[model samples]
Target: MSLLVTLAASTEELAPLLMPPLAFAGIAAAIFIALGFVVFSFRDVANRQGQGAGKSSDTHGSGH
Candidate 1:
């Protein structure tokens, strides 16, 4: 009887460890979606160099 009770208690305790797979999968899917967004938004555009202080292409000293 004691062994049966201990087995039943152990089984009951282990029930939770078997659950939460779907929760983990959902979190994984969200992380994957965020990573996809970052990978898709990355681009390399030429002729887009930064213009620092006192740099201009127009006439007059308008860049100062």
Candidate 2:
């Protein structure tokens, strides 16, 4: 009974420090995901630039 009481007391004191580590991990994960999306989008933009498809829309007005 005494051990349970002590353990519960420690847990209450440690909760604030514990939650911030989890929060930091979550924030780091979000930053990683954002960077991955930026790299992927830039890669695709570069691929589009190489395909010569960017001018098709500009010439569409002449067809009308």
Best by lDDT: 2
TM-score of 2: 0.42
Task: Note the clash tally of each candidate.
Answer: 0, 0
Worst 10 residues of 2 by lDDT: 11-20
TM-score of 1: 0.41
TM-score for each candidate, following the candidate numbering: 0.41, 0.42
lDDT of 2 by residue, 1-64 (tens): 9999897778454344656677989999999999999887777776777566657756677553
lDDT of 1 by residue, 15-44 (tens): 555448898898899999999988766643
**Clashing residue pairs in candidate 2 (N, C-alpha, C atoms within 3 angstroms):** none
- The stretch of ten residues in a row with the least summed lDDT in candidate 1 is 45-54
